[model samples]
Target: MLRQLGSGAQYLATDINQHAAETTQATLEAHGVHADVIVTDIMSGLDKRLAGMVDVAVVNPPYVPTHVEEVGCRGIAASWAVGLNGRQVIDRILPAVREMLSERGWLYMVALEDNDPSDICHLMSEMGNLREMFQIDAADYMMSICGDDSLKELSSPGKSGSIFYLSQDERFVIKTLRKTELKILLKLLPKYYNHVRAYDNTLITNFFWRPQDYSERRKKGSLCCDEKYVLH
Candidate 1:
């Protein structure tokens, strides 16, 4: 994504581990991409400068339910360890993400059923009135596509350990699915396309895949799930 952002765009990345930060820099170098990588715990030191300047924010936070002590280990556990109800880090970052997002910014996050995805969206909406201006209109648009007032109901079980959720704007989605889920989606793609064509008002747009292996991609601690798919 940083590669596609162009040289003029400022791409910034953060991680708690210094090694992870350096590894990210090396990967970017190998890909001919450039970004300002920092070792900080979820925007800790840069929030003030980045406030309201981020046009796009993507977060694949730690969502696995575990003990509090397992939340912030320095080793590989940093990649997936989360606290009670799987919300330790997620709860902390929500406010920061809300404060940093530009007026038109969009956030794409990966969530689990235990995270209470609906409440997460609602919390974000309530934070500093993020959705106060667009609540009524956004609700109407959301209903046109989802046929309901709540976007949460659109969620369906995708795999053994994951689910999927689309935002009110239909711009991006929070998903975690498996290769089996991808296969089912591929089989239904034709009908889905036809339905979108028939309505001509939805946002089920774009489909593409990277050449890299999905498991190898996740080893980098990316949010891209097993056999990842992005429904724009």
Candidate 2:
């Protein structure tokens, strides 16, 4: 996404980690593209100049649930060490997004169940003049099948390297499980099924791999093939 935008626009990549910023620069260079990669906490220094000028804002923030004291840590840990409910950093980002976006701008953010996405959308909708124009659209079975906001949650599998996301209506969680973890999950399905049957309660619903052929998706927009499973 950044690569495509950088080709035709004034693309700037900012990160709190200096190493991350440098790495992004190197990646862009390797791709034969150019961008200003800066090390800054969010949009700290660039706010004033960029305010009301941004057309799109894309964020994949720190949405991992963690201890309150670990919210703003140093090094690579900072990438995922979000405070309680994973909302500390995400909550802060809303106001910054409002300040930086133009009247015609739109924000695309990725959030986990711990981040409370519905609440995030509601809060953003209520911000300034956005209430009339902004609405939440979730991509999930609940939204597609039930057409009502019925969602559920299961215990979080707190693994540092894993990435987790909830369906739009929060009916199911989608995790990027490692190969070994995927193997374990496949082995546990029968036990999980019997346990759920015994209790008559479950948040786990479906699991499958997303097709990685980007030919069709490329017609729609950029191709994002980062995940391997669609677990619910």
Candidate 3:
């Protein structure tokens, strides 16, 4: 899929197992695609060449919890033998990938529910310096308010009865609001915006947009308001 979507981009794939690397190379060749495939433990040895230069990365590491001894074993068992919380390989891969990512780089990783994906996200946020990544300036605020499609659904049906979404660049969070909440927010929006604009070091959440009605034209129910939150 990366080959299909990312035309003209340099592609590099790594596997600890030599056979797996060869298989990946064969698959690419069969499809008339060319990519560099290496037999190494997740981005090893290529760090010097690719560090802080990778634009996009996709990882499908071994995530099945098994005995520690099975982790580095040869053949098929090595594919799914993640030690303990299914994060042995995943934990190692995260930092390496972090270092390889450019400022605008994006990572797509496969994780099971048991692997605690949420915690992984938090870890990446900290490692990637989310304060800088999520910082919203005046121009960014205007663009987001003008109906940017970067806001993709993150999660839904939270304890607050709201749906949460994160921007594609992970710069902003969009949260659905209830009718009553929207009314209160609308009432204070002017004052809130003024205060935030006046004080650069304010601790208040930076709200980029007012409530946006997202109800379908044919829908008979109340309009759903999506509130955009920029963490600055």
Q: What is candidate 3's CA lDDT for residue 48?
A: 47
TM-score of each: 0.54, 0.53, 0.54
Q: After best superposition, candidate 1 residue 98: deviation in angstroms?
A: 0.7
**Which 10 residues in a row give candidate 1 its minimum summed lDDT?**
205-214
TM-score of 1: 0.54
- RMSD (Cα, Å) for all candidates, in order, is 15.7, 18.0, 18.4
Q: Write the per-residue lDDT of candidate 2 for residues 1-232, one digit (tens) a residue.
A: 6566555677777887888888889998898778788887677656546656778888888889988787657878899997778876676577567656777889999999777798787656544232222232222221321211332323444544444555555545555545445446534644654554455344655332221112333355532333233344
lDDT of 1 by residue, 1-232 (tens): 7677788778888987888889989998999997888887787646447766788888888798888788658688877788778876776677678766877998888989998898778756654352332232332322332323323424545446664556566643545555456546544644654565466555654332111123543566643455443232
CA displacement after TM-score superposition, residue 35 of candidate 2 (Å)? 1.2
Better of 2 and 3 by lDDT: 3
Which residue ranges in model 2 land beyond 4 Å of their true spot?
1-7, 130-232
| Candidates' C-alpha lDDT | 0.61, 0.58, 0.66
* Model 3: lDDT to the true structure: 0.66
The candidate with the higher TM-score, 2 or 3, is 3
